[model samples]
Target: MQIGFFAVGIGPSADPEIIALTARTAEQAGFHSLWAPEHVVLIDQYASRYPYSQDGKLPMSTKVDILDPFVALTFAAAHTKTIRLGTGICLVPERSPVVTAKEIASLDKLSGGRFDFGVGVGWLAEEFTAVGVPWERRAERTREYLKAMKLLWTEEEPQFTGEFCSFPKVRLYPKPVQKPHPPILFGGESTPALKRVAEVGDGWFGVNVTVEDAKAKIERIRSYAQAAGRDPGKFRFMVSPGLGLPVELDMIKRYRDAGVHQVALGAIPRDAKGIKGEIERLAEKLVVPAAKL
Candidate 1:
C-alpha cells in the first residue's frame, strides 16, 4: 500500500520554506503524496462538531493559520518533482463550480498530471452562512457542482445548467494533462457518500475508519459500484486515520489487508523543526520499511 503525509497547512508549520522543505523531504523519502486540508474561513466557535475526532472537536485551535489548499499545493509543487499533491478535502459546495474547475485543471496541468482532488460537502454551517451558501441541500449542490466541473473539463465548448450552477457554452483553455481531469476522491462515510462515489468519484477517501470497519465499507462500496454498473476493480480505496492514532507497521498492514490502496497519516508538527523531524521519523520508521514488506 502507498503511504502519504496529511499536512494541515496551518499553524506555525505553514511557512513557505517549511512547506517546500517538507515536500522535498517527503518526495526524497519516497512518499506517494502530500495532502493539505481546506477551509476558506474559520470562526472562533462552531456548532458543527468535527466528524473525525472522538469528542467531535477540531484538533487545532481556531486561531491557527489555514491556507488555501490549491495555493498551498502550488507551493509544494514547485518544491518537489514526483510526490503527488492533493487537497485532502476541498469544500466543494462553498465555491463557484466554474472557478474551481479552472483551478483543478490548472493545478493538474502545472503539476504534470499529479493532482488528486479529494472533495466533500463541508460540515461547517456557520462557514457556509458566512460564504452565503445555504446549508440545506448542500449534498445536492455538491453533486451538481462536480457534474458541472466535469463538463467544463471534458468538453470543448462546455455548457451546464443545474439547480445551483448555470453556464453558457464557453471554451475553457489548458485542459488538464490527465485526460478527463484529475482523480476525484470523495471523502465521507455515509451511504449517500458511497453512492456518490460509485456514481462519479474515481475513489473513496474514507476518514477515521478502523481496519475492520474499512474492510466492510470497501466491500459495500464495491457492491454499490456493481449495482451502478461501474467496474469495482477500477476504484481506489484510501483511509486517513484520526489524528493521534498510533501509526505503526502493523496498523499499516491491517489497512493493506482491508484492501486499502493508500493510507494517509496526519503529520502535524508545532514548528518547522518538528515538521522536518516528523517527516524523517515517519519515512525512516514506517514508510521505508512498509514498502519493503
Candidate 2:
C-alpha cells in the first residue's frame, strides 16, 4: 500500500518556506502524496458537531489560519516533482462548480497532472449558512456540482442543467491533463456518503477510522459498487487514522490487509521550530519503511 502525509498546511506551518520544504522532503522520502485539508472560513461559535472527535468538537482552535487547499497544493506542486498534491476534503457544496472546475483543471494542468480532488458535502452548518448554501439539500447539491464539474472537464463545449447548477454550452480552456479529470476521492463514513462514493466517486477517503472499521467500511463500499454495477476493483480506498495514532509496521500491515490502497498519516509538527526534524523523523521511521513493504 502507498503511504501519504496528511499535512495541516495552516496555522504555524502556513509559511511558504515551510510548505515548500515539507513537500520536497516528503517527495524525496518516497511518500505517494501530500494531502491538505480545506476550511475557507471558521466561525467563532457553531452548533455543528464534528463527527471525528469523541466530544464532537473541532480539533484545532477557531483562530487557526486555514489556507485554501488548491492554492496551497499549487505552491507544493511548484516545489516538488513526484509527490501528488490533494485536497484531503474540499467542501464542494459551498463553492461555485464552474469556478471550482476551472481551478481543479488549472491545478492539474500546471502540476503535470498530479492532483487528487478529495471532496465532501461539509458538516459545518454555520459555515454553510455563511456561504449562502442551504444545509437541507447540500448533499444533493454536492452530487450535482460534481456532475457539473465533470461535464466541464470532459466535453469540448460543455453545458449542464441540474436543479442546483445550470449553464449554457460554453468552452472551458486548459482541460485537465489527467484523462477524464483528476481522481475524485469522496470523504466521509456515513451510509449516504458510502452510497455517494459508489455512485460518483473514483475513491473513498475514510477519516478517523480504525483497521477493523476500515475493513467493514471497504466491504460495504465494494458491495455498494457492485449494487451500482460498477467494478469494486476499480475503486481506491484511503484512510487517515486520527491524529496521534501510532504509525508502525503492524498498523500499516493491518490497514493494507483491510484493503486500503493508501494510508495518510497526520504529520502535524509540534511547532514551526521543529518542522524539518519532524518531517525527517516521520520519513525515516514510518513513511520510508512502510513504502518498502
The digit string of per-residue lDDT tens for model 2 on 88-193 reads: 8999999999999999999998899999999999989999888888998999999999999999999999998999999999999889999988999999999999
Worst 10 residues of 2 by lDDT: 266-275
TM-score per candidate = 0.97, 0.97
lDDT of each: 0.88, 0.89
Candidate 1 regions with alpha-carbon error over 4 angstroms? none
Error of 1 at 175 (Å): 0.4
lDDT of 1 by residue, 9-53 (tens): 777657887888888988998789999988888878888988877
- After TM-score superposition, the amount by which residue 171's alpha carbon in candidate 2 deviates from its true location, in angstroms, is 0.6
Candidate 1 has a TM-score of 0.97
What's the lDDT for residue 273 in model 2? 55
Supply the global lDDT for candidate 2.
0.89
Give each model's clash number.
Answer: 0, 0
